[model samples]
Target: MNETAVTAASTAPAWLAAARAHANRPTLRMRMPFVVDGEDVGSVETVVMDRIVEHLPGGHRLFFHDAAWHLQSANGNATQAMNTLAQAMRELGLNGPWRNEQLVVCNEDGKRIGMIERGLVRPLAIATCAVHLIGTAPDGRMWVQQRAFNKANNPGMWDTLMGGMVSAADSLEQALERETWEEAGLRIADLQSLRHGGHVDFQQPAEEENNAGYMRERIDWFSAVVPAHIEPANQDGEVERFELWTTAVVHDHLARGEFTPEAALLLADYFGW
Candidate 1:
């Protein structure tokens, strides 16, 4: 390999690497408006245009209004509105049992603004909370997992050892503990300190994988060291395998755009890059 390759592998920051991976990915510019009791809250993309049109009262195509897209509604019940939209997506084959989890909704500042069904949150461009845990072995190797090929989003991509969206009812720490046990089969208390390593706020327009209009997320990052004697096995089938990689190896994958953008961000933060 040339010096450029070596330097790129060694020096690239996680955020920059993730940005580069998404730099070439296509974004859907058009946003279908989401309104609640006349208050425009968010927008969805064209992927679910048919479903929205069908369920909307008048079957009106989304139109631009006040610099945002919107659908007409007579009612203002948030729960009913969310349930109706979620059902639409489900019938259209966009969401299912596993992907249709509950997620915490928040504003840009990361406050507990509201709650929504996870499957509809993305399309509506609602901000959601996610937790990522970085597991490190005593000898300095990072534990990473490959997502199962059948996952709804970012399938077949490399990801942090354990990560999941936080439900509306779960706190960040609680979500971390549950996700850790589910994804890696490790009880939180069995590991070393689950240190708070800061966070990453990611807001990007919808890409191809996001049939939902966009992805706006606030991720709480954590790191822990796993003893060599302890092995991580996947309880949920979302992960295919787990392996230990050096910092350099991780960076190389980042350069190659192998890790999911969210995973890249967590790993980058973990490496202090």
Candidate 2:
């Protein structure tokens, strides 16, 4: 992890500066193709990674065979082979309520290419979409959440008020509404001034060897104002706790490198950096 402090001299918050630094870092390219005995079976995404071989769950292994990175599997059937990989991830305790969430697959241009399980997407290196809701109160304080300790990705890190992948069957609105209610106990009605903020393209090397090999996603960002009277109560167990922080405090954490990379970017974008 790059701990080099994003210089505080800039007008932009330190968190946003750090996010920019992360955005500029180099990535290792990887291919996720389930090849058995030298025959291609299905969809393949070029995964950007920090390393090639990771120690993720299950009995899966990636090896250079026949001049390519082969995700070795016992099952030759394509569906079964993918399942084998998903099962392994579950075993590693990466699976969550969003585990089987089906998300539309896309190329770098955001084209509707196909669909895949959310939990399996990273392992397969497929590009997917997600929503992050930046909630603010009338007091001008922003709301943030601490991710559950068991989360498969960026566990225990600070995150936007709400975040979740846009599943294959869901519209952008539906994914946002669902995640808001589930993660922060906010119904669509509780959120005011709802608007599409923007998007962030994030890719990074996997942190733990037992985690999904690479982290990649296109974040569809949203911002809203919630009633000061309504405190965000988490319905799902994905959040550890919620904190309402002044803008300056957030910048401090970002400078200290405490926020999750994605959340830092989202916060920075929301603040108009």
Candidate 3:
């Protein structure tokens, strides 16, 4: 092992280190790739694979080949086939909370290959995309929202100003706009100095449902300045409330683990922490 490779973590803030540790679990190494039509997409835990083999209908067709689970019959009508599989998983109690929304599934090269129920993404380890926005005031204070207690994942945790998954039917821009308006009641067009701040890739054993699934997603983060005259109101029930905090307070919250892991990582990167 390279001895010098381990010192990088010492340079990052303790909060960021904790966030990275939370987002990248060692259990991910135990999962096998989920292959579809000769394309490597997603992964499956051994336990999950076993459950599928024992409880899923037509599950016998899935076979282990080249160290991965190969689904040969999922070639045509990929979307329909994936949806059918997701529904079957739901029946077997292998899925997360169902959203009735479709999330686009992409291959290793980021090619859109299919669409599956949002709830099934974590169960199947399918990589999905989301948009997260950081709203800031001219005085360097940040706007954050508290997730509703009823949320399926990370309920009641503080998050970025606005964050949401990119549905199969919506583009990145559309998702950003929709999430911003719905979660914070702030129109994207009205924000000042809006800019995309790249993205963060996250993968970990799902903690929300007792590790019954895995989370693999790419979060596209953005930053903007909200006008002092404009106040954020929750137009959607997904948010419990919104609050603006100074930089020092935000850092303290992060250190004390008040923010969600995703938001912590994003904010850490934003502040170069």
Candidate 4:
């Protein structure tokens, strides 16, 4: 065997060795579609990530949540997958104890608003499972947010919207309402939650393409479309700058590394682009 093969063999865990031997091994991985109110979550992974985003909103955390059903579907590699994930995370500079922290904070009631996944539950705003709110101008441009400099994970990166973790009190609508107000000054009262969009599809990143094991859970994806021009109040604390964009602009921006690799993968999968 070659040096790399010998090295990999030396470090191979017993479980993976067993898993790999079963060539016809069926990676029994899949997630139930997540939805809220009426909207269908287009991608489960994005929605789960969005659920965990947190910002201290005048003491109110704009909590997002993942359905337990969906949560159980992803990362089912069990101990073996975990070992591989840990090794990969370490090699990729995303390892460390801090990576396991939860991104969302629940209310006093301890409701399940959202959870931190990816071994480290980073938070995000923008509802993908239920009612989604997209910011745009008169044209068909999409508005995006540049993550603040003080941000730890994606500092200097841009996103579909800026959001934070919050308590899971009140209804999902109330949470979104609270999130909109917190991330950017906007009231979504009388807003409509888009219903029914699940069985989310996955368009994995290059590395994940052959990783059939990693794609078990289907991230139900959902997006909300706001009818009017959204003028979000700049919450300097949670956001950097906001700009309206066309699909073309977003396409280029994504290509230029404006969004995090994970976010980019999700956006692509969401639109099935």
| Candidates by TM-score, descending order | 3, 1, 2, 4
Q: In model 1, which runs have C-alpha deviations exceeding 4 angstroms?
A: 1-27, 38-40, 45-76, 92-98, 107-114, 210-212
Model 2 RMSD, rounded to 1 decimal: 7.5
lDDT for each residue of candidate 1 in 1-273, tens digit (9 for 90 to 100): 212223434465535854745633434576655654445556665556655555544333344466555544335445544556567666676643335567754434455434567777766777678899888887777899999998877889999999998887788999999999999999888887568888888777655453555776778988888888998999989999999987678778977889988887666656655
Best-to-worst ranking by lDDT: 3, 1, 2, 4
Give RMSD (Å) of candidate 4 vs. truth: 17.8
Residue 138 lDDT in candidate 3? 66
lDDT of 3 by residue, 38-128 (tens): 7788888767767665443443246688889866553366676677677767877888888999998899899988788998888778888
Error of 4 at 216 (Å): 13
TM value for model 2: 0.72
Model 1 residue 39 CA deviation (Å) reads: 4.6
Which scores higher on TM-score, 3 or 4? Answer: 3
Compose the digit string of candidate 4's lDDT tens values, residues 1-273.
112112223332233333223322222343333332223322233333243323111222222355421222132322232233333433444422333423332222344344333332111111222223344444445667777787655677877653433232334556556666767676665333433233332232212222212222223333444456456666547678877776667767766767754445445544443
List the pairs of residues colliding in candidate 1: 33-69
Best by lDDT: 3
TM-score of each: 0.79, 0.72, 0.88, 0.43
Stretch of 10 with least lDDT, candidate 2: 1-10
Among these predicted structures, which one has the highest TM-score? 3
Tell me which residue pairs clash in candidate 2: 102-168
- What candidate 2 gets wrong by more than 4 Å, as runs, is 1-10, 29-98, 107-113, 209-212
